[model samples]
Target chain A: MIGIDLVQSTAETLMRKAAIEIPDDYLAGLKTAAAAEDGDLSSFVLEAMLENYAAAKEDSRAMCGDTGCPRWYVKMGNEARIDGGPIALEAALRRATASATSSVPLRPNRVHPLWRTDHDNNVGIGAPEIEYGFEPGGDWIDLVTVHKGGLFGTDYRMLFPSDGIQGIKRFFLDSLVAFGKRGLACQPAIIGIGLGGSKDACMVLGKRAACLRVVGDRNPDAKIAELEDELKDLGNNIGMGAMGFVGKSMVIDCNIEVGYCHTGGMQMSVHAFCLSSRRAVARIYGDGRVAYRTDPQWFTDYQRRETVEWPQAQTKSG
Target chain B: MATGPNKIRLSTNPTDDAIAALQIGDIVYLDGTIYTAREGVYMRVIEDRVDLPLDLPAVSAANFHCSPAATQHDDGSFVLGAVTATASFRFSKWIGRWLAASGAKLIIGKGGMSPEDYRDHFVPNGAIYLTTVGYGTGALLGRGVKQVRELHWKKELGLAQAMWVIEVENFGPFIVESDVAGNSLFERENAKIAANLEAAYEGTKPAVLKRFGETDDRKDEMI
Candidate 1:
C-alpha cells in the first residue's frame, strides 16, 4: 500500500524528468560536424536533412516529431501492492504522455494504424510498451520510461553467420556495414545484437537489444558486460558518427541480449533506432512506489555524472 | 553566426514563382498564411474545402503539410517546431497545385521532387523548399521557440491526423530545401546517393568497414 503515490509520481516525475533535452556534448559534436565543408551542408539535396534538425532544436520539441511508439519497462518488489486505485496506471501513462508532449512538446505522434489517423497523444496498440519484473522481497518500485522517436520500420535488419572465420558477432557487424553502404539512412543508431534464438525469438531479441540500458556500467551478467565493451570499441572504430556522416561516434551505444536457443541456427538480428533517440525509463512499484528521479539539470547541460553504484568491475572469470 | 531576413513570398501551392526565392543559408521568416493539410487533412481538405477554408488567414509563405505534427510552423506568427516528415510524392492529387495556389513560397521536407513537382511547379515559381535531418530532433528543439498556433484543418479526420493551422515564432537556423534562389539540398543528397552507388559498384568502398573486426576472415579469433 505504501509507495503508491511514489509509483504514480515516479512515472509522472520521470516523464517530467524525461524532457527530451539534448546534451551539451551532442551540441558540440554537431557544431563540429556542420563546420566541416565535407559535411555536405552545401549539398542541394541534403538541405531538408539540415533544416529538420535545426527546426527541431529551435522549437524545443520531439526531435523527429514521430514520437514513436511509447513503451514502459518496470521492475518492482513482489509483495508490494499499488496504493492507488485500479486505473491509476492508465491515468499515469496518460499523464506521462501529456507531460512529455507539453514539456518536450512531442509531436502528438500516436496515430490510428488502419485508419491512418493521428491519436491526440502517441498512444496506441503495443505503444508505450510496458514490461514488468517483480522481485521477491523488496519494498520499493523502480520504473523505467522509454519514448522511441521515429518509425520502427525496415531499419531492423539481420544476417546469418557465414561460418569458418565468421561467427555471430561478425554476422551482426556485416549487416551494419551493408546497411551503411546501402545508405540505409540511420542516425544515432544503437546497434542491437541478438546472439542466439529461434528465428522469431532471434529477430525479436535483436530488436529489443536496442532498448537495453547504457552498457558496460550495469549489466545483469559479467558475460554481457564484456560483450558490451567489445561492441562499443568495434562500433566506434568504424567512424559512423552521430548522423552516419564521417566521424568518430558511429553509434550512441551498442546493446546485446543473449537469448538461449533451443534450436541450432546461429541467428542474429540488428535493429537500428535513429538519432532522435527519444527514450526514457522509470521503474514503478506495485505499492505505487517510484525511484529514478529525472535530474532537472540533465536536459540543458548533460555533463557526465558518475554511476550511483559500483559493483566492482567483474573479473574475467566471474 | 546570425543572418538577416530577406523576405520572399510563397503559396502553399507548388508554383514556379514560389520556388524561385529560397537559397541556402538565407534566413526566412514566413508571413501571410497558408492552410494546414497533411495526408489525412490533405485528402479531407480537397474533398471538403472547394475553396481554401474561409476562416483561415491567407498564407503567403505556405509550405505543403504531410501531418499536422509534421507541419514546420503552425502559423506564420508563432514559433512551432517546423518540420517536413516525408516528401510530396506519396500525397494525393493537387498537393503541388495546393501549394502553388496557396501563395506559399517554400516547401520543407526530405527527398528531391520529380520534374513535375520541381521544374514545372517549384523552380519556375518563386518558392523554396528545405530538408531537415531525419534524426536530430533533440538538437533541433533545444534551441527554443517563441509561439505556436494550431491551424484549422478538418479535425473530424482525427485529432492527430487532422491538419490544423497555427503560427510559429523565432524559427531560426533551419535549412532551405528548394529555395527561390534555385538551390535544392534534396538534389545534392540524391547526387551523393548516386555517387555512393557508382563508387560501390566500381569496387571502391569505404575502408572503415574493413577496419572493424567484422570481416569473415577475422571473425573467429576476434570474437
Candidate 2:
C-alpha cells in the first residue's frame, strides 16, 4: 500500500522538478527542430530558445516565465489502497501543490476570475485540476503532474455525427494556421488532436496528446499513426517557421488520441502547448517505494518498472 | 548584453532616417532604457489622457509590452521573477498611434503589429515594432534588467498585470516585425500560408474521402 504521506511527498517532488526543468524529451525535440530548421532567422530563434532553457536549468528557475496552471492525471490501481479516502488524497495533493509553489519557486500564476480576487497560492476551486482513470487490477498508483502554461491558447469544437473526419481536418488545419500565425503559439508547436468521443473525453485526450512525448512513443494503431503522420505533413504548409517567422520547421509533432463514441455525434478538441510542454510522472508501489518518470504513459499498457511485495498495510488501510 | 550571434543595436533616441534605415526581417538589439506597460494601465493612460507614468525623455522613451511576474520585498521593492512579453497585436487599440505621437521609438513584445497599423501610425511617427522569441523569456529577463524603478496602479490592477517602469541597457535582441519600412512578417507569411494550406487541404482529400465523406459519390460534394 502507498501511504498518504508517501503519495503527497512524491507528488510534491514531481511538481517541483517539472516547474524547474523542461522535461528531457521536450528539450530534445526543440534541439532536433533547431537543427533541421531551414530559415536562418527562424533557426536563430530556436537556438536562442534552447539557450534560454539551458539558462533556466542552470539558474534553477522555471524555463518559461509563465509557470502555467497545475493539473494531475492519476491512474488508480484497483488493488492498491491509500491510508485515507478520496477526499483526503485530494486534500493531500492540494497541500503538496502549495508547498511546491513556494519551495520550488513556481511563479504564482493563478488569478481570480472576478474582481479584487487573489488566489496567492495558485490553488482554488478546480485548480490543480485532477483527472483520473482506474486500472482494473494494479498494485501501484501513478500520478502524472501536468504544469500547463497558457503560452498557446486551448480550443474545443463539437460536430454532428455527420461532421466526422472533414470536421476534424477543418478544426485542425484552422488551429494550426491560426496558432501558427502571429506567434500565438511558439512554433515548433506540438499539436494534440482528439477525435470520436464525447465532449469531455475528446477535450481530455486532446490536451494529453498535445503534451505527450512524440520522440520515443508510437501510436500503435496504424490508422491513428497515419493520422498523426498526416498531421505533421499538413503542419508544414503553415510556413510560419520557428516563432511564426518564415521557416520550414513549424510544428514539432502531432498526436491524436481517440475515444469510442456513440453514433450520435463526434466531438473534437485541439490543445496546443509551447516548446516547453511541462509534465512529470511519479509512481508509488505497495512497499512504499516510488519512482518518477518524465513520460506519463497515460494509455500505454506496460509491465511495471519495479516489483515490490504487497504490504500488509493494504488490508488495514482499506 | 551578449553579442556576436546576432545583435542589431538601436539607440533610445533615433531620427526618422535612423528608424527608416531598418528594413523588414531585421533582428535588432536595443541599447536603451524602456518603460513597461500592460493593457489595463495603458487603457487608463488613454482614457485619462495623462502623460506616461514615467518621464519619457529621462528614460529613452521606449515601451516594452510586458507584465513581469514579481514578488514584493519588505521595503516595498520587488524582485522580478518572470518578465515575458504579452502578444502586442492585441495590446491595445491605437497603440502604434499612441507610441508614435508620444515620441516612443520602438515597441518590444511578441507578435508584430499589423502592417496597416505600422503604415498609418508607426511610419508617420517613425516607430517600429520589434518582436522577441516567445519562449526565451528567461534569457531576455536574465540580460540587462537593472532596476524596477517604479510601478503604477498596483492597487487597482494587481502586481503581475500592473504597469512597471524598468531600467536596462543593451536590453534586446528582437526581430523587426513592424518596421518603419511598412512591412509585417506575419502578413507576408500569411499570404504564403494561404496558398500552401489550400494545397494541403486538397492533399488530404484522397486519404480521408472514404472515412469522412461517408461514400465516394458524396466526396466531391463534401469538399
Candidate 3:
C-alpha cells in the first residue's frame, strides 16, 4: 500500500517545485518566443521573465508573488490501494498544501468570496480543489498539482452550430485582445481552447488543456491539431506581443481540447496559462516507488475513447 | 545587469525635477524605501478615515500595489520570498485621494491606469506610474528588497491586505508607463496595435448570441 507519509512528503515537494521551477517544455517555448520577439518593450519583458525564472531557481523562491490558486488532479488505477482510503489521501494532500504555504512562503491568495476570510494556509471551503480521474489498469496513483493564476485570461461563450469556426476565431481574438492589453493575461502564454461540452465542462477542459498539458504536444485529432496551429499563428500575427506591445510573439502555443456536446450548441472557453505556468506531477506505485515528471500525461487514448465499452481487442493488439 | 538607453535609477523620495525628467517608456530602478498599499489600505485611509500608520512621502514616497509572498514566524521574524505588483486600474477611484493624502510621487503596479486617470489625478498630484516588468518578476524584485521594516494591520486586514514597509536598493526594473506630463506608453502601444487589429480579425464573425453590455468596438479596451 502507498504510505500516507510518503504522499504528504511528495505533495509538499510538488508544491515547492511548482512554485519555483518553470517546466522544461514551457521554458523552451518561451525561449523561442523571446528569440522571435521584436517589439522593443515586449522583447525587454520576455528577457526579464527569462532572468526571473533563473532567479527563482537559484534562490528557491516563488517565480511569481501571486503564486496562483493551488489545485490537484488525482488519477488512480483500478487496482490501486492507498495506506488509508481516498479520504486519507485527501487529508494528506490538504496537509501538504497548508504546510507548503508557510514553508514555501507563498502569498495567502485564497479567501472567502464574500467575507474575504483568510485561512492564510490556502485552504478553505472549495479552496485547493481536488479533482479525481480513473484509469483502466495498474496499481498506482498519479498526483498532479497546478498553481494557475486565478484572475483574467479566461472567458466562456455559448455558441451555436450556426456560429461555426468563424465564430470561434472571433471570440478567441476577442479574449486575447481584451486581456493581452498591458499584459494582464501575461501573454506569450499557452492559450488553451475548449470546444463542445457543457458550459462548466468547457471551462474545466480549457483549464486542463492550459495547465495539465505541456507545450509542443498536439491533439490526437488531425483536424483539431490543424486548428491549434492556425490559432497559434493567428495569435502571434495580431501585432501584439508581451505587455500588448507591437510585435509577433503573443502566443507561445495553442492547445485545443474537445468533448461531445449538445447537438445544437457549441460551447467554447479560452484559458491562458501565464508565463509562469506552474505545474508538477508524480506517480506513486504499490511498491512505494514514486516517479516525478513535469507532464501530467492526462489525455491518454483510453481517457478520450468515444466507445461506451473498453475495446479490449484493439488494446490487446496494440 | 539588464541595460537599456532609457534606464534611470532614482530615490524612492525623488525630487520633483527627477519625476519631471522621466519620459514614457523609460526604465526605472528605485533605491531607498517603498510601502505596499492597495484597496484594503486605500479604503481604510480614504473611506474609513483611519489614522495614517507612518509618515508618508517622508519615510517613502513610493507606493507599491503589491503583496509579497511572506510568512511570519512565532518569534515575529518574517520570511519574504517574492514580490510583484497587482493590477492598478481597479484602484482608480481611491488613487487620487490616496496620492493627495500620502504625497506619493511614484505609483507602481501592473497594467497601469487609463491615460485619463494620469491626466486628471496623477498629473495634478505630480505622480507617475511605473509598471513592473514581466508582471511576475517576483524573485528578481524579492532580491532587491534588503529588509522588511514593518508590517501594519495584519490582524485587521489579514496578511495580503496588510501594509508592508520595506527597504530596498536597486529595487525595480519598472517601465515608466505614464509620464509626469500624462502621456501613456500603454495607450501609445494600444493605438499602434489597434491599427493592425482589423486585418488580424479578418474572416472572423461575431457570435450569433450576444451577451448583455457587450461592446463590439475593437478599439475599446477592457481596462
Model 2 TM-score (B-chain only) = 0.79
Q: Residues B93-133, candidate 1: write the lDDT tens digits.
A: 65566555555555554333443465567656555555434
lDDT assessment of candidate 3:
0.92
Candidates, DockQ: 0.19, 0.29, 0.76
Q: Model 1 Cα displacement at A231 (Å)?
A: 6.5
Stretch of 10 with least lDDT, candidate 2 chain B: B214-223
* Winner by TM-score between candidate 3 and candidate 1: 3
Give the range where candidate 2 chain A is weakest over 10 consecutive residues by summed lDDT.
A301-310
- Show the colliding residue pairs in model 3: none
Interface RMSD of each: 9.0, 5.9, 1.6
Output the lDDT of residue B146, model 1.
29
What is the C-alpha lDDT profile of model 3 across A1-318, one tens digit per residue?
Answer: 889999999999999999999999999999998988878888888999999999999999999999999999999987889988999999999999999999998999999999889989899998789999888777889999999984889999999999998999999999999999888998889999989889999999999899888899999999999999999999999999988878888788999999999999999999999988999999999999999999999988877788889887654442
What's the ranking of the predictions by TM-score, best on top? 3, 2, 1
Score residue B216 of candidate 1 by CA lDDT: 39
* Tens-place lDDT digits, model 2, residues A119-180: 54578877878877666567888888888766455677666665556667766766665666
Better of 2 and 3 by lDDT: 3
lDDT leaderboard ranking: 3, 2, 1
lDDT score for residue B90 of model 1? 50
